[model samples]
Target: MGILNVTPDSFSDGGRYTDVDAAIEHGMDLYRAGADIVDIGGESTRPGAARVDAATEVSRVVPVISGLAAAGVPMSIDTTRAAVASAALAAGASVINDVSGGLADPAMAGVARDAGCPWILMHWRGHSRDMAQLAVYRDVVAEVCTELLARVENATAGGVDPGQIILDPGLGFAKTAEHNWALSRRLDVLVDLGFPVLFGASLKTYLGRLLAGPDGTPRPVDRRADATLATSVLAVAAGAWGVRVHDVAATVDALAVWRATGSPRLAKP
Candidate 1:
């Protein structure tokens, strides 16, 4: 999967693709660069960011989704609102990447159930604006797993097929750098839940902090591609189902190398 943010305030790559034409072009570029699917989000879920109204989100994503759909690029609607997801699906999106994990909106499960498309349920405690305060976790991995399982139960009970469900650990949202690293280190536990796990650590703040300079300033977003690539490779090695990334070509190249090496088994059998 490739990441494409159509909002002006996403932590990284924001404002760069807010224009409809530019967003479409970038979506196509991701597809051409070997992305199996392009995940397009209209809202900025970066920490402390304000939420955009549903109408605005729908307006931002639908046109780009329509354009990309017309050009034959497979796309996923990265939203928590059922209305926005429905509009994008009508505009040609085939998947729902809900960071809220169907918790934000009561209607989201119904939308996913009706669409019968893949529904990615990310582990989220709250919206971006208040998420920082909600990051408190005694055992990050265990709590995340329990929370994700509850989400899975909700999704299944809400009539979405189990086969269509995908799980994401919600790396930066409401998670400290230590929490993010802990989840990454034990990603296979999430994978073992019998659902396809989607790892999305592309240009996240945790990686920036991990690569901070001497002055303690975090590494710039653009400079974190190598770290992102390393995470992608390692995630796949750890049995993650897919990785959502911004530098699609680099990740694709690295994975190709991993594949060429007979795709050696790294996860415990």
Candidate 2:
């Protein structure tokens, strides 16, 4: 999956694709670079970011999705609102990537069910504005897995087809750098939960912090693409079903190398 943030305040690549034409061109670039799917998000979910009204979100993503879909590029609607997902689907989006994991809106599950498209349920504790406060976790891995399972259960009960559901660990949503690393290392726990797992660590704050300078300034977002590729390769090697990334071509090349190495099985800890 390739990420296309069409908002003005996403942590990375914000304001770069807010224009419909630019967003569509970027989607085409991702598709031509080997992305299996291009995920277009309108609202910025970065911590403390103000919410974008549902109407604005729909307006931002639908045209781009429509353009991409018309060009034969597979697309996913990255949103929390059922209304936005419904609109995007009508515009030819075939998947719903909800970072809220059905917790934010009561109608999201119904949208997924009626659309009969894949739904990505990311592990989330709260809205981005206050999610950092909810990051408290004793055993991050075990807790995340358990919570994700509960989400899956609720989604299925809400009428979403079990086979159409996918799970994402939601790397930077509400997690600290430590928690993100811990979850990344133990992703097998989530993958073992009988659903496809999506790892989305592309250009996240944690990677920037990890690559911080001696003076402690975080690495810039553009500089994090190489680290993102490393995580993508590792995640795929560890059995992730997919990875959402900004640098699609780099990730594609990295995965190709890993596959050329016979796709060696990652060792158990």
Model 1 C-alpha lDDT per residue in residues 61-88, reported as the tens digit of each score: 9999999999999999999999999999
| lDDT score, candidate 1, position 176 | 91
Evaluate model 1: give its lDDT. Answer: 0.94
* lDDT values for all models: 0.94, 0.93
Q: Please give the range of 10 consecutive residues that has the lowest summed lDDT in model 2.
A: 260-269
Show where candidate 1 strays beyond 4 Å.
Answer: none
TM-score against native, each model: 0.98, 0.98
Error of 2 at 210 (Å): 0.9
Error of 2 at 118 (Å): 0.6
Error of 1 at 202 (Å): 0.5
